[model samples]
Target: MEAPGGPGAPPMWGPGRKMGFGAALGSRSKGWYTVADGNLSEVFFPFLDHVALHELRFFVSAAGAPPVDDSGDGQHSISWISPGVPAFRVETTHHEYRLTKDFFSDPEENAVLIAATFTPELPDLRLYMQASAHWEPGTDGNFGSVIDTHPPALLLQQQDIWICVVGPFSRANVGYFRSSDVHIDLTDADGHLTYTYDRAGPGNVSAGAEIGIRAGAFQLAIGFAHSRADAEEVARTALQKGAGAVRQAFERAWRAQPEIPPALGKVSGDDGMLARASFAFLHCLEDKSHAGAFIAAPAAPWGETNHDGNHVYHLVWPRDLCRIATALLDAGDSDAALRAFRHLQSQQRTDGGWHQNWTLDGTPHWQSTELDQIALPILLAWRLGVAGCLDHDPYPIMVRPAAQFIIREGPLTTLDRWEDAGGLSPSTLAACIAALIVAAEFAHDAGEHVAANHLRAVADYWNDRVEAWCSLPSGQYIRLGSDPDRRPTEGSTAPEFLELVRYGLRRPKDDRVLRSLQGVDTSLKVSLPAGPSWRRYAGDTYGEQSRLAGTDRRAGPALLFDGTSCGRAGANT
Candidate 1:
């Protein structure tokens, strides 16, 4: 979903469903859902109440059933689900029962349309909704409801955004009752409402409203507003415009997305579906806010740690962001790339180091002294600027410090990308060498010829150091230069040689490069479903703890998906 205004605007759909953050619509601010106890979460106008889109459902009677029944028959089964158009489809093979529910939100600000198109049309269909506020203390807590007295039953979140649940308003059969209460009198009075936390409400009953949907199509539109009256007005307009118009409006709004950044237009058939889904999942992972960067996963941002007592991937990792940004650029979207660049720039340390991950506000967390984080950004920015993916300069503050830091840390002992507090590794030095060339070019473009020369000279020296110390007589490479203990021809060393060639640091036929690749293939390679996998390092005591010496321990012989020979997917990582 595009922002309320137009194209060139940020998309709103996010990883709401994947993360179970109650963010089904995945709006940067507006959409959220609940997965607790199989209950539909609340979607709140984020700017208004700490409300969520929580209460939403569809009730259909196949053949015959009450419009307000409490239970569902197996007859109402969904035959298909789609991420894009046609949204969700329900069909019954035994009879002529079929209906498709299309759920989508507005192009501007906030609004969600849960529309249904029926085949063999059921005139007694009901669009069930609760005018429930997730917030407590009612209006003071940025929550309120507009029920029976309005054009459509509506729920408001502090007047900021309102959920206008549209239904057949002319029907007087609707009344407000407790959501969970077994016995309660129905209130058809001027004012009636309910509140339920989509996450943790047991007896959380909601006073709801229902609209009788006519034959062809119907909708329950959740709209954003700043006041109760405005919400009521939006409900009025939506009722008048109807579900068909709302769907059409949204279609027009989202029409250009598949064309921009991705177009995925070139791929056809199942390949296209997979490609689109991949792009959509990545986009869903995005926070969609102007200041937000693409987070690593479904987890919410800003947390220092996850449930397992380790750092969460939900926050931005500079190295990870650089790679993600490059992919976006490759896919023809420089906006995400540029944003990733800016976000990483904001996290660079004064000493030219980066934290392992960072929150949205740029706060450092899980600090790791990895060299790539320092070097990768410099390379990414320079590449983007040169490739024309970057519209603005990212080097005025990035190149020099990165070059200096890599120079300072290249020959020193530092944590490897594997997070081990081991001494210097060749891959770290190799990556720095690549980044240095980019930085030198950036320096040259800025008229800093002397600094450029110094960077180039240092890069050459590091390249020489790597070749001199890490090379073994077996035509293979090692991780540390000074010691051979705990060394078994590291699988991680295999890529350094290839990288050296890619960045112009080494010749393709260079003996050391050939030796390393040949050695890794012969020593670290293992069979995998797709192809071969490599171990983190030779003598890699990955899963078991005791590698040096222990009677009760054994090294893991697992193959990881990250192209490593460790067991499972992330044994060494």
Candidate 2:
């Protein structure tokens, strides 16, 4: 899809086309706006609407600034700098800047990437941008929801610029610095030479030179500066050698990325939708070695609150990582798939639960609030083994402790009695069972009789529990016994249950597996007046609704199950 704004849109400017002294503004949707000053020296994008499921919007703007002095003179500093935009309200005293719109509609979403930039009229002007994402609370009014509210505040003061991305209970911050001490000099046939120096380190640096040229419909230039020399000399040299080389290198890098054929149109129909969904899921997987696959909406920003301590929609979790990783491996991103497992291994807690949140600093808060710990990691490990990322023997070593934790601790017992301590609910127990089944298969492959027997024993225990629960009506499952407010009617429908049934029944047909799937199929199926067996809800139904609403609300839409069985075509398993 085309970006929300056309070329050269203005900052803080609303939709429509308008001409000004040297500026024009336009927008493709309410979520985005752009502006271009007629001078052609700079452009600004003050609002970026990323489709993050969080309740936040990002506002960013950029402009050119005139060069003053680099002679260490305080006279060059100006406190009243302005980009000539009215929509941005700057509070100097509080050092806070905000947009004039209600960016969050629900308590669980916030606006992110509200930023502004100042460029210079010089060919290589230094770029200065201030960007930030906001955070809010979740819709559920539990204390655990509060943990998802505020954006993590990193302790770093100023040695490095803060790069903050909001996750479930915190923000991920990476510090970057530009390397100094690198200098270059270029000369042409005319004896004109331009000398440039590198100013590394995070804060802000100026690119003082721009090679005057264009390549492939883009303005091309070498971004550099004179080495404390005459401006005219540097400009002449940059125009001749530096600019050309930089432009070529950048073009090559841009073209190096994997390409999508132009024939790939908007994906429609079932097959196309599945392909597109799988592609998107793969694209979101972080290529970093230790990082788990993150399900971040492309370009989505963090959410913010309205100073009332009310929460909005900026959140993330490692559990989602496990889910997305399973999808990624299914989609053929084996490296990323393995990375997710490795991340789980690195972040597992001593209590046998995985940390729900993976912050930038690697600190696991171990919020004993929810109980996906034993379940998600174990399942991921099993999938990794099947995918050949783990060996059979190692599989049992990793799976046994987690399973033992669940059984010995009474999977249904709460870790935090006040707020549903990280313990097994039906959904979690089902996930644990599924992982053990996978482990058992791996053990059988490795000829480890002891491991296989132990796994079978554990699986039997889970099977008995599921069988007892199945004795209930079609929809009921065992709830965590320790939850005081637990109701027979309250239930969760994560793909976890479907995964358990599918994995458990992979061998010779088990009646229990068939019964469970039948129950799930019955409860999840929906029929329209026109047809039956043609539709069903996937695991992401709620997540998709949350994305559309721009908030974290559970009462959005119901999933439907048509003819497609849970494991065969539907997404849960």
Candidate 3:
């Protein structure tokens, strides 16, 4: 049930796509991103700046044997074709090269160091430099000024930030080379500094400063800052401590993470690897410095092959966050669960419901015109309470208002989880009912009997109408309280039925529950690659057109219910 798709429009591309080693480091402030491959892929502080400078991967060429590809597609071709090692080391029979990149975060700034070890048979280690401000799909973000200062330092500006590439390498062709031309041909240079811009090429236009090493082993420290002073300072420090030390520190942080508790069971073999990777994915998607908000995925690939396609997922949906919270609590990481819950608490709308989605910074993004969003936070808060992760007084200011909104709007025509506005979705009703019952329990725990009774009554009222609200006139269960037709059934509603049972609103043998399961299993239960995944509803447009059909790109053939149905699946007899 491992669904590996996000950030990269294709399963084959994007920083997050091939990530498995969990060796990547992110800034606490989330101002920077550096993968183990030595590419400073993301720098989004003052502005969103992304570039790939690995084109100059310390390749060695004979005196006249032509420098490595100055073409912009070199890195892309390498990433797409060469493949990245899970750990971080590259080798060949003649040239055995070991490269390790690690980034460490500090209150002052985040710095990255790349340590390389290679054989000395080759002459000078040619350096390559191509940088750009934009992604790979459009106009190549041109190269900026390459200012070389005394004591061996070069400041290159791309997009908004100043990148300082400073090291004590024995030699550099462009140890100090400045180019006013936005499009300098790479082949003309001696592998010192080349900022090649190929707008017509299949990959992005970027420029990087390549370093040539006569000695087999050397360290390069790359530092990023909005201003030149900061970049130089950090770059100087990085040049001093080297990449090895940063990698060691980063490894320490990775090890510091509490072990996954045994309660998660014997998560081993293929499933174990998948589970570990999924957990790593969640950690990879989050920004540790800024309130620990999680992005849907890294924002690198959109500007690459996906074009602007990957912008939508870099968000923190409360619904999605709830899934993360559940995982954390189950893993015995109550502290993480609490932080996520508090983050959710921060997003509750003034009206007691929540926005459909939000940025990791807590800014509201796209939302639905439905009740489920409101139901999600309440459900999380209640669960946190059960997990003993709730920090404050039970059922704070947001809880009661949310419960009341469900009481008032639970049965009304609204948006379903899929963002369609019309009828109440069975999932929406079930979520609302769960929220109310839990709210009542929390209120009772707090000795607020009156509030508890009122919430219980609302739960009961909604429990009775849950079927009626989601039923079609044809006597078949509709995807929502109101649906145009019942032909394409919903698999989502099956587990919502179980939520009703868990909330004590229905019996496991309830006829409606059985019928809802039967309806979806009969129609919507198409076999996905992993297993049987239900369409959100019939005629679902998601992954509707296959790439093989030469139509719109489809992200799926994936099941919508990996984490979606776990709790509800518990009610299955």
Candidate 4:
């Protein structure tokens, strides 16, 4: 039976389904678009953290066969059009026809342009464009309509957000989702648009139009604006400019980035290309309005069957920011790295703490606090200070408050980096200890001798207790701080113990560290044909289940529920 309308929830957020994303560099463009399954997936506007458009899908049908949804039912593959830019060429080979979509964002305005071409145009080949506009972060009450325009267009709105799609179409329809929409008609046995409407609103709705394919090709533009007129103009301008020209601008904009640093210029071939790609992707993740803010990802994890809107992945995390900042610093973009530090300063809580994660506007989400998150900023500041990148002192604004917070809540944390159980996690403790030492140095440089001495003492105390609190009787480090006598096997191993060496608290050759390494390898590591990989830990049940499994395993103590008898498939994350 056909489910009608469209997908009930947003598409998957993992890169597998979300694929690659592209946006114009700098602030000229305010929209970011993602490609997946040979079609446009989520389109974020104004901010990287907020998802405005659910998906813009293309469909094709012949005289007597069911219409093939380009993103829904065909075998599709994606490759980068430009080596380091987000521009992508997604090709889908269907049983009846082949389609190619070249995706890129407009560098001059807020729009997503796609140059679509279908080969072997079948007899009575009918092309359709479907727009599923969530408007906000999730799919809820939305209004869609067919606007009166030259080439015909569609407008969707939710609250203050408005999105308009413009292209060349002969016929169009808008209706409520599921019960009476174009999707229902497209999925019917005949694969035709039998039912149609002028507008649908105040509930889940969808809009579709019959695209006029000229020479087996069509161009599309999706634009964001505050009003319908503005959106129309945005989309019209991009379409008028043509996809090829806009794409050229997109490539030129990215290629115009600052010259590669010595660290990046040293490598060549695929490795060098991969490094440049990393920097380009990192650039795409940052918020346009907020200089230093970058979302963790442009997708929602487990979005396939998980329709719960509350569970999201596109948000800011201080822990993630630390890595991003450090990467930028290593890539020799000190300006970007410093901007990230300043952004952190603004997001820091009045008590010198940070929430688990947050939106770009510093709106906190998630309840737990990981000490490493509180400490990593100080570590980054120290790194920047050491590299002489600290144009203005961070001592009073950032370093002082963060160091004080760690002093008030060190060693013991409410949760680990995984947001699971909280205790004296060696990784968290390592960061805290390392942060305190650096904070003391910053304080000493700032001439606050008393504060500097106190921070150093705290660092010393935490460093001394590293082994006592984390080590088990076997000299292996336990995953968390607890009574070693009653510790279970599942609690005996974790990959986070390596932070001891990472933060310089212990030598790589240390006997205790070596023993913990072996324990982790024996318990959590999985040797695959490609290479050796490690799960979060043993007895962990926080991932997709295997196709062969019936139910998930019983979750560990820190986790809520493990499956009863299910096998698990390893995630590539």
Top lDDT hit: 4
Off by over 4 Å in 3: 1-40, 43-109, 115-129, 134-143, 149-160, 166-205, 211-220, 265-289, 300-310, 394-396, 412-414, 420-422, 446-448, 471-478, 483-537, 543-573
Q: Considering every candidate listed, which one attains the maximal TM-score? A: 4
The C-alpha local distance difference test score for the whole of candidate 3 amounts to: 0.50
Error of model 2, residue 219, in angstroms: 9.6
Error of 3 at 531 (Å): 6.0
Per-residue CA lDDT of model 1 for 1-573, tens digit only, reads: 101111111111111222122223334235433221112334434421234443454333332333322112224343214433223234322133344554445544356555665454444343344434433222222233336554436443533444545565432222122322111212222112122211112112233444444456666666556666665566556656665665565455434454434345455555455554455445544555534366665432111111121333556777767777777676676776787787777778887777877665666667767787788899888768877876666666767887788788665446766666556566667778888888889889889999989989988777766655566656566665654243334334444455567667678898877777787677667777887677666655433222322121110111112222243222222
lDDT of 3 by residue, 483-560 (tens): 323323332333344556665667777676677678867756667566676555554443312223222211111123
TM-score per candidate, in order? 0.58, 0.44, 0.67, 0.89
Q: Write the per-residue lDDT of candidate 2 for residues 1-573, one digit (tens) a residue.
A: 111111110111111111111111112111211111111111111112111111111111122322121111111111111122111111211012211211000001111111222222333322111111111122111000011124321111111111122221112221111111001111111211122222212222112122122111111111111121222222224333432343333234323433332234344343343354344434423422225534322221111112222111112355666777776676566666676676666666665655545442345433443444566677787677667876334454556566556556544535421132343444555565666666667678778778778877877776566534422344433223234333243343322344445455332255544554565566555565654441122332221212332231111121222222232223332
Off by over 4 Å in 4: 1-16, 121-124, 135-140, 148-150, 265-271, 483-492, 527-530, 547-573
Model 4: lDDT equals 0.76
TM-score of 3: 0.67
Instruction: Pull out the clashing pairs in model 4.
Output: 13-300, 551-566, 552-563, 553-562, 553-563, 554-562, 555-562
